[model samples]
Target: MTAISTALPAMSRRDEIWHGLRDTFPMMVGALPFGVIFGTLATAQGLSPLQVMSMSLFVFSGSAQFIAVGLVTSSALWVIWAATFIINLRHLLYAANLVNHVRHLPQYWRFPLAAMLTDETFAVMELRYRQRGSEGYAHWYYLASCIGMWLNWNFWTLVGLVVGQSFPDLKSLGLEFAMVATFIGIVIPGLKTKPLWAAAITAGLVATLLHHLPYQSGLMLGALAGVGIGLVLDLRRKKLEASVYE
Candidate 1:
């Protein structure tokens, strides 16, 4: 009976991981072209295949990689690093939000999970945490999602790097639009609350107005603006609720 009980839990956890992978498949479809496009553009910008793959492997940040590529030629090394750092500041917010759930995990488990974190994985994992409330096995689900995205990104990156060698004009095909459309798909469904809608609008307007900013600093500014607005509104709502309860 003891052995059976242990085996049952293991089986259940495996099921959770499988579910996470299944849920992430849709997002992977969107990320596929984005990764390929990055690979294509990076090579066009004079990055060797090894360098391109290394960036994807080690950094695992889509926006930062893109920004780095743009700044690589004309900008100083520090400038490229700083631009990518600023653009990825939003990950801090994602980590803060998820800290409570993963804090109990050991360093071994937590480190890789943290390393694999990305915008798309965060979105899906956040939704899962809300629904399931971070029972111990949730990390396994997160792991599955992270691994799915990591593999998807690396695989498509290789595809792009190989194909780009033959067709130098591959980027001109406008396939990057797939990434934009995918983001729309991801963002629209998450706007269930007033704060979310307000934040999205604020960020969109700020980014659009500041689109000409160098090194994509506009994106960082827009993200900060949206987060600030959302936080203020959320706090005000909480204060109002507290007053009503009192």
Candidate 2:
């Protein structure tokens, strides 16, 4: 109903779609190598081509899928569940803004967009909404951006599968760090809140302290502790706000 790209003078629906794809380029740069690394390494870790590709298509979370692949054999299923859940908790923050943007749309529109939503999509979409203001067919931009990323991730994963089957040692390329870089780009800007910064620092510290633990259980414990602490602080802030309002 409203033009989300109000800032951009005038543009057609197709143009908006292309603009969404164009704007997501920088994010795709970071995701490209990460997807390849997952494709290459996941199979080596005992996942079949079907399973790996299914993860990209269905799970569709770069960090969480990587973690799942890494833990698929060594850790228990519960561990994989807990770890990926913690890793994806960051999406909650992203979803808050996302829901507000798409709240006006129908279920058909919102469901897929929310399902395929990622850190990169959220960041770019947030910027678009804030800078441009959603007034027209901005949902097309949102949808196009998401589809662009989804296709990019799936394509690279297939390439990794094809190439990794032949080479078997792409991990040695040190290309995995690209995702880490992408995460930093995602997190640093969002650390505007005290709870987020505190949780991040605490999670790292606790995980590092417990790094020597068996099955890497320390990482999960540390993450739990960080989440606990963050929730406490957030609740306290909410009460204070409510008291002030009263």
Candidate 3:
């Protein structure tokens, strides 16, 4: 309690934003290639420049929008819509986790911040909230981080669209490696404990085992399994700690 009390006040808005940007850079690397892919694919699928840009602005979700565009090209409207909704189901978890932190903000800020929240942004924010205990203007911190991600994503999307419109080989520019490297950087550090490792391996195996499931249901199931394993392990650990204290 004494340590938390002392540390909370020392963290200001500027410090929060600075650390948020630093923490967010690796994920931004992943977003760059993804944005380029979206831009090139949108052009290849015959969308106009305005429409291609609009997809980024309105949809704001990289994976969902990409899947949606593919479905659109194949005239699979209903399936695409369903898939988009499913891909975005993770946002519900984000919203639930962040509610206590951001609900105190005015509705205007809350709405836009929620709009900007992505998996990467949520992961960073969740760790921060867990560490810092949102006593001050934590919503501002979350927004600052979210804005960094949002602006970078839009900017790269614009660049991708322009390059896509001009060049044919833009997709082969070795952009895919950025995403792979970024994922490794983030996920490897996170595997510091046995529970985290167990959850990750379980999730991977479940995903591979059920890869044949249609409509991407396997992904949702795998995520559920991973979360359940983590929760059960965490609960058992807590019980052990409580017993030791007793």
Q: Supply the global lDDT for candidate 2.
A: 0.86
Residue 25 Cα positional deviation in candidate 2, in Å, after optimal superposition: 1.0
Q: Rate the local accuracy (lDDT) of all candidates.
A: 0.87, 0.86, 0.81
Task: Give per-residue CA lDDT, model 1, range 116-189, as digits (tens).
Answer: 99988998988887766677588889999999999999999999899888887887888788878877988998
- Note the residue pairs that clash in candidate 3: none
Residue-level lDDT tens digits of model 3 in 141-182? 787778888888888888888888788578787876776677
- Candidate 2 lDDT by residue in tens digits, 1-246: 873535467567998899999999888888998889889989898889999999999999988898898888888889888888877876776788667778889999988888988989998898888877775778899989999999999999999988899999887999978877987887788677888788888888999999988556676778778888888888999999999999
CA RMSD, predictions in order? 4.1, 4.9, 2.3
Q: Point out the higher-scoring one by lDDT: 1 or 3.
A: 1
Clashes of 3: 0
Q: After best superposition, candidate 1 residue 12: deviation in angstroms?
A: 1.2
TM-score, structure 2 vs. true: 0.76
Candidate 1, superposed: residue stretches over 4 Å from native: 1-11, 242-246
Q: Estimate each model's TM-score.
A: 0.89, 0.76, 0.89
In model 2, pairs of residues that clash are 2-135, 2-136, 3-135, 3-136, 4-134, 4-135
